[model samples]
Target: MKLFNSLLLVLIIVLNFMFAEPSLADPPKITKSPDYVEVTKSLDILQGQLAATKSGQARSETLSAEDLQKKIDELSFQKYALEKGINWGQCRNETDKTIAVYGPKPKKPKTPYDNTLYFLGAGQATPTNWDCQGIYLPNDTKLTSLNTDPNQQLEGAIAIKIFKGTQLIAKNDPETGALELNISPSKFFKSGEINWYIPNVSERNIAFRVPDVPLGGEEETD
Candidate 1:
């Protein structure tokens, strides 16, 4: 009986070591830029494929272990290149629905502002690939994932203004030093989001303004 018990204990120890899974990896901590988002997503898919292959899952039939490993290595390199080496300016789409994103308008207007970058699906986060200037979330005059035309994107878009500069991006005092703007690496709509609220004070020179809540059903339509 004692000999049998000893043998069983050894087997359990060996099995535990053999079957133990690795700890989960931390999320990438890059700026939440477009390139960063795309690369991280591709990397995730590649890694998942490789994992499935190792586990003898359905992906195993399509990808041999060697091929899958090679693909993962290549994508990992792309992910590293996008890493900013620090986790700053990170943002996540905390909503249940997709929301459109925007970057700063280029200093020059050689091309029209797209007004919308990409629609971040729910629970997705900005990766730590490129530097983030800051993401603009619109509350009104919404563009969507479907609107591809640049000219059409600007309709009811944030106006170029003197004090606040535009909607969803204003200061409380409307002056140089104000604590109105929020920081990133944050949960949108979680605490208090600083989205667009179209008011007359935004840009009178533009000679037009959209409603604070747009007439249509675009509610980010976040």
Candidate 2:
């Protein structure tokens, strides 16, 4: 009876060990499919062919029938990939609407005499409000008969002069009678003043005056 009991105990141990050992037959491995490998190789070959074409080495005549078939197969696979992407909601939306991305408005160019030059002639006639005023030029000459008529006024022509130090630069001769004055760039003048003289005290001359705000619009003399 004891012998039979020992044998039974040994058999139970053996059965437990057998059951504990891992199964020799494995579960299906997570592996890439054969089709996937073929597709990957096809893509590599396609890229090579394209490179060859770019390098001027690929020719339709040179390619074997098998090579052309391989290229066609790769194209078909790519098309399938695209189709799959669309069906799986992996494709992105295409938008062609142009958004006018406006940057900060470009800044305006600045002028030299933006607020420095003034009209002095109209002060005599209009008192506070002046028209055809004498603008002091840096060249030591006064401008008289300065007109603001849009059609006749000398636009951009220097009509008077203001001088510093000894007026080493001779002032313009109005007695020469306001000849077609060609204003030149002056090195002596602090800020290139156009010079002319007013013979009459009652009326002020409007020399080409720099605007208080000179950069953009025309200056208005009251």
Candidate 3:
């Protein structure tokens, strides 16, 4: 019985060690810098679907050859866009008081801080000594109101100044294409998961090719 137990214990340890061995595949070069591997994969899948559609039309009695061709063209454009990549800059700003936001017309999300990737900035919750983005406001002015109007949507690349109460805290640099932003919660803003408009990326997507900060301070970025 003792011998059997020892043998079993040795087998378990051997299995554990073998399983713990690290993978040998080369690490991706962009591990330190951001890269768009997921986007490429999505394009690949779309292309595959387009191929499958073509194959199906060959076997199907219902889809006319012309319809199949149209599908190919549409999916081709989508795949091309994915390959080109979309540039979008977003940020998260927070406040003790309620923050407001608007835009991306045809509003699916009804409130600010819904679920988009964004930079984080905090302004004064109280009136006095309230310095946000180097700005001060009157007590009744309420900083949250600055970017609260959902009726107005900012598009094409442009610098964005974030505020809380009466203070300007952070700024987002402009880009040449579509983007999303998050300006709320005022706290819990910096955590990366709160990344503002990642998956929601759509037609207006532009590539955020440059490093986040310009000649200004680092806080100007995420």
* Top-TM-score structure, candidate number: 1
- lDDT by residue for model 2 (52-71), tens: 76567875565664665666
List, residue by residue over 127-164, the lDDT tens digit for candidate 1: 44222234433323222321343123333333221111
The C-alpha RMSD of each candidate to the native structure, in angstroms, is: 18.0, 34.1, 16.6
The most accurate candidate by lDDT is 1
Model 1 Cα displacement at 215 (Å)?
45
What is the full ranking by TM-score, best candidate first? Answer: 1, 3, 2
lDDT against true structure, model 3: 0.33
User: What TM-scores do the predictions have?
Assistant: 0.26, 0.18, 0.23
lDDT string for model 3 (59-145, tens) is: 445545565455556445534443443322222233322222211222333444432222222331222221122121112221232
